[model samples]
Target: MTNAMQLNLTTPGSNLTSYIATANSIPMLTAEEEHALAVDLQENGNLDAARRLILPHLRFVIHVARGYAGYGLQQADLIQEGNIGLMKAVKRFDPSVGVRLVSFAVHWIRAEMHEFILRNWRIVKVATTKAQRKLFFNLRKSKTRLGWFSHEQVQTVANELGVKPETVLEMESRLSGRDVGFDGYQDDDDDSFAYAPAAYLQDVSEEPARVLEAADWSAHNEERLTQAISTLDERSQDILASRWLSEEKTTLHELADKYGISAERIRQLEKAAMQKLRSALMD
Candidate 1:
């Protein structure tokens, strides 16, 4: 089963095949219908119009999302992200642009899907800038020849894409690389010492100085909090203890019952205690 839970705002248990079938079943709208829906959504924020416009084109998003299935991501997630882009495009689409809704939506759909791909494409992001994003898709397409690009070909791509040859080379390098396992162990190979992410990447968590700094920071914050709490009045301190410091926080009504006061009084006391605590902490 395709993981539909990864998607957003789509029907439950809706697979790509099912989504395609449903969307394709809806006839494509004429220019008049498409324009009317776009105007309703863009001018009046008619959610119904938005839904109507989006429903018919959902399959198109799924089709485009299918093309990006090679990135080892959940298909439903890509479709979901594409759906968001489609909705955004629908909201901004100007019917007077002399283009079909599909043409306008295509850019938005691909943009959202591309963002999702780059963010989750690897454990670490491969593309952080517009140029890198362009390189990412183009580089993948360029790799269709089944070998690395020659220096001359790299220069050609660089010139055509209006980027430095080195930038093209760098993006290509990042694209060709795969995520390495941090630990040295591998299930496929018994050789425990070979092909480890730990070997190629440094583990900052292992640094004693950094570890100590984090520990010290946590300890100091705890001490400061204790000092701040001590500065509060007896009633305010007790209120804080009962409301927040306890393992089971006391609700306003519960505290009010204990204090023989209204819930509003308890709330006021709680707010005043928080203000005092904030001031003490700031000092």
Candidate 2:
């Protein structure tokens, strides 16, 4: 509701242990107190009531955030995101539903943390689809021992998660992979820097010698092709041009109609013209 209130509850700048202690020190609300706060907020749009509802629940957010510790994100940031979810739950909470705030808020809290993990976990996203997202979070827990999953283990995980074995394998691969810098790390020494992708990968397209050679070769072929086409009869030349050289190529049927011949005859003429051009270019 207010910066002061959030800082008092989270104290995000402080060390993680201190933040956890502060969150745990906050008193829990009784059902009656929680209900009253929910009613006040829902009826009157009371920010203070919403803040009270959120304070006692910061501990629960910390607990949920701790479960995601293996993801390599900062515990403090995860807790902060979970706190935001708790606040959203507090605002939209319906006491009339006969559910406690924590039970209702768990989904919202985990949702925010999951989003943070997916976004920051990899430079490339590991999960884009709904099934992939489900597998991304659950795959690590499904593995009993590490390294890689055996075919049987993969199938087991797939069945347990209601996904295909291929999906399980793909998500497992993604989870196990680490992001590497394309140009190599800044701290890399001379020998290591030479092995980096930027050092070894060449962009030959931008090389002046290669560029000039390709252009010259293309021009030489074009000159030979023009000379070869000149040796063809007028009809053969026109058909060849319309069929192969024009921007808007003429269809055999169109050529047939124009020349008062059957489409088969047009095809035969085209074939003969191509053979003559090939022979001339060879010479």
Candidate 3:
């Protein structure tokens, strides 16, 4: 009997309306029949019994999927996910549990639908943590009016959902926000395009004008430094170069040895040169 019923069962496909009608047309099983099929699948792993168990519950999956229509996802996709949950529930159904398949399967069905919504609802995921997910589904339903939640409402939702008011507010903000293109839309006018993130959030380092200005400023400072260094006497120039400019910089004692002078005298000369350079550059 189960094999004949399985042969008659048709899975949902691209034609959603037709699939839904077929699902609704399938007969609901009596408690005895449901139990027998569940026992067959659980004990003997009968695929035929599993098919019979799942086929009749397709309408229930459709019913459950309808509640998630506001998530801006395709109805067909949600129904398909719910159908998978129905199959999983059938595979795990225990005949001795003394509960109908629908009751047992509701959790599995909603779980799949919830997962699907979380994945496809937005480009960026809104709810990641367990608490956020709980708040995500329940917060909207908790609202009495349309606009942003008042302090009292936030507190009420937080208390009821066992989360902080701040968390509730954060999720509300996420839900109310919309995804925007960084470059903006193709049909956007000048006014709208000017407001896009790409317009203002720019890399000044990459700008031609800024890059040219930075280069010119650096060149000017280098020119000034060269002139400043030129004002020092030849010996002072050599001392400064040896002490500061050289890659393998000389120590004060090393410069003193080359100059045939005490290290303290070399230090004083180097300091005087640096002071003259500073004064020239400032002028």
Candidate of highest lDDT: 2
- Give the winner by TM-score: 2
TM per model?
0.40, 0.43, 0.42
**On residues 62-180, what C-alpha lDDT tens digit does candidate 2 reach at each position?**
88988998776788889988887787788779999999999999998997788677658682378776667677778867764544788988887889889888888778888878765
Q: What TM-score does prediction 1 earn? A: 0.40
Tens digits of per-residue lDDT for model 3, 1-283: 3555444334455787877887788899999999999998888899878988998898999999899987757788888888888888887889898999999999999987886776566623677666566778787677645457888878888898888988888888888887665443343132444355866776778799999999999999999999999888999999999988999999999888888999999999999999999999888
Cand. 1 Cα-lDDT: 0.78
RMSD of each: 18.1, 15.2, 16.9
For residues 139-211, what per-residue lDDT tens digits would candidate 1 score against the true structure? 7787776368998999888887888999988888888787644443343233554564546678788699999
Computed on alpha carbons, the lDDT of every model, listed in order, comes to 0.78, 0.82, 0.81
Query: Which scores higher on lDDT, 1 or 2?
Result: 2
Clashing pairs in 1: none
